[model samples]
Target: MNYTLDFGPVVAGLPDLLRGCAGTLFLAVVGMAIALVIGVVGVVLRESPVRPLRWAVIAFVELIRNTPFLVQIYFVFFALPLIGIRLAPTPTAIIALGLNGGAYAIEIIRGGVQSIHKGQVEAGFALGLHKRDVFRFVVLRPALRAVYPSLTGQFVMLTLTTSIASAIAAYELTSVAKLIENESFRSFEVYGTITVLYFLMSWLMMRAFGLVSRRYFSYPVR
Candidate 1:
């Protein structure tokens, strides 16, 4: 009952924390971009005619989805150096985040792609669209529209996962918070403030996604 809260350290570290927020956003955005690319490409290859290519994508998805992300980040940061593939902490964190997010993205987007009706693809072809055009316009667009909410929700989770990158000394909010807490011994205040910041960041991300959904995925008005 004698404990009192002090926010002096948290207030002093606000500038650094704001910078860390930027770093977190940077990592999340880049990682999500990479994951989206991987999801799309993996889905294509997952449905490829070549059995080996399909198997490879399946193995990747299962391996990542089944493993711990901490281990994955450790492998990327520590093990890769053994193969002469060293990367800086930031790059390592980005790669780890991308791969982790991408595995789940592959499954999420595959579900979306599968939700498209075969008849719509056939109609696109009947309209003289090329195979690629049919897939892009008739299949991919509508499928993405259908799954946009799920995909964005996954991306938000991926954003939160950036906290794990701190284990590797990546320059993000959690890493910065750790430093502040170590120096100030104000774990409660530091963590509590950063917790609010994280919630706000997630809320902001959802709002941004809402704007995108309204703009790009909304059904056409009559």
Candidate 2:
């Protein structure tokens, strides 16, 4: 069978495509923001003076990290309605991404924090620095710097995972591509172009984040 690839349908949909991109970006940005906040909370709880709280944090991390994101999203989107909670598709996608990403990042950040030398903490104390100042100045910055690259990489991965949002009717880039493909009946060309766009966007975001890392975190160029 000879297949003729037509760009007309996809090309004509560029305006709507851009709008879909914006929706994806919005969800991703919100999700990442929530994730970062949760990550910090996770770290704090894990290090808590309260033993039960610490264990709870560990359990939360393990559960979220080990499970498939699709299952989690379905629980929120479909099952939650039974419990009288129904999130809009965009909100659900953003929340799920944030919660999932944060769970993974907690370990990464925790590893970075724990990797800091014990001697450094003692030295800060010997210098008469308050606990807050010591943690903020001595430990936190170094830990974040250590895991900067991993965090950036995760965000890039999240770009592709936004397709899951499409499954829940979030109307992200991939979802839009699906819509276009269905209407235009050009799965090969539509998907081929979508793949190209995904790669391009991921690479560009990675490069941009790399620059930000170098500028803000002082991560060594290697």
Candidate 3:
């Protein structure tokens, strides 16, 4: 009951923390972009007629989904160097986040694709659309629209997961906060401030996503 609160350190470190927020957003945005690519490509392969290809995608999803992300990052950072694939901490973190998010994204996107009626796909073909056009216009776009909420939710989670990258010395909010806490011994203040900052970042991301949904995914008005 004798502890005194101090926020001087937190206030002094505000600039660094703000930069860290930018780092966190950079990781999240780049990671989500990679995840989207993987999700779309994986879903295509998952639904392919080639049993081996489908099984390969299935195995990848299961492997990533079943494993711990910490271990995955460790493997990438440690094991890859053994094979002459050395990467810096930031790049390693980005790749790990993308793979983790992509695994879940594959399942989410697949559910959306499954919800599309088979007749719709046929109708696209009937309209003389090329195979690629049919898949893109009739299938992918609607599937994405149907699942945009889930996908964005996963991205938000992925943004939070960026904190885990701190374990590997990746330059994000939590990592910066850790340095501040170590230097200032202000665990409560440092972590408390970062917590609020994280909440704001997540809120901003949701708002941006809402604007995108309205502009791109909303159905045409009658």
Candidate 4:
């Protein structure tokens, strides 16, 4: 016995898959933006003098980092509604992705912040810069430069994890593949094509990250 492959259905569903790809990219972009904000705020709070705030950030980071992301999304999609905090599927998926990525980002950014020399911060303040300015220029910028590679890698993982958003009927790449497989019963072809598309997307994302690093993080040569 032998198996034969058919790609006719996959070819026909290219448009749906493309739309799904767009949705996936949208989620990743918005989710990463939210994650960056959360990470920055969390790191700042972790260093804050306020004991409750520091403990809150610690609890958030530990909870999300320790739990399964799928369960997190389910909670966002299903549980939140019961408490009068309803959200559409797309927003729910984005929030879930952001929170999940943000937890790991907090740790990554904290490591970068800690790696900065204390003298640089002191020097910034001695230059008449305000505390906020000092944190922004001397600490945050350099810290980001130090940890950007790791941060981008984490973003890549988040992008791939968008596939799980399909569980909530979020119209993304994996959802499209599932629909195509259901309609055409061409599991091998549909998934095979999606695998290629995902690879290309990941490669493009890495290239974009490279450009961002070169433009923003490059150190001046003497």
What's each prediction's clash count?
Answer: 0, 0, 0, 0
Error of 3 at 129 (Å): 0.4
lDDT of 3 by residue, 51-96 (tens): 9999999999999999999999999999999999999999999999
**Candidate 2 lDDT, 49-136, residue by residue in tens:** 9999999989989999889999988888999899999899888898899999899888888988999999999999999999998888
lDDT, candidate 4, 1-222, per-residue tens: 787998999999999999999999999999999999999999999999999999999999999988999999999999998999999989999999999999999999999999999999989988999999999999999999999999999999999999999999997999999999999999989999999999999999999999999999998789
User: For model 4, what is the alpha-carbon lDDT of residue 183?
Assistant: 99
lDDT of each: 0.95, 0.86, 0.97, 0.95
Q: Give residue 215's lDDT in candidate 1 (0 to 100).
A: 97
Total clashes in model 4, counting residue pairs 3 or more apart in sequence or in different chains:
0
Q: Whose lDDT is greatest here? A: 3
Query: Against the hidden reference, what TM-scores do the models get?
Result: 0.99, 0.94, 0.99, 0.98
* Model 2 regions more than 4 Å off: 219-222
Winner on lDDT (1 vs 2)? 1
Compute the lDDT for candidate 3: 0.97
The runs of at least 3 residues in candidate 1 whose Cα sits more than 4 Å from the true structure, single-residue gaps closed, are: none
Candidate 2 minimal-lDDT segment of 10 residues:
16-25
How does residue 128 of candidate 1 score in lDDT? 99
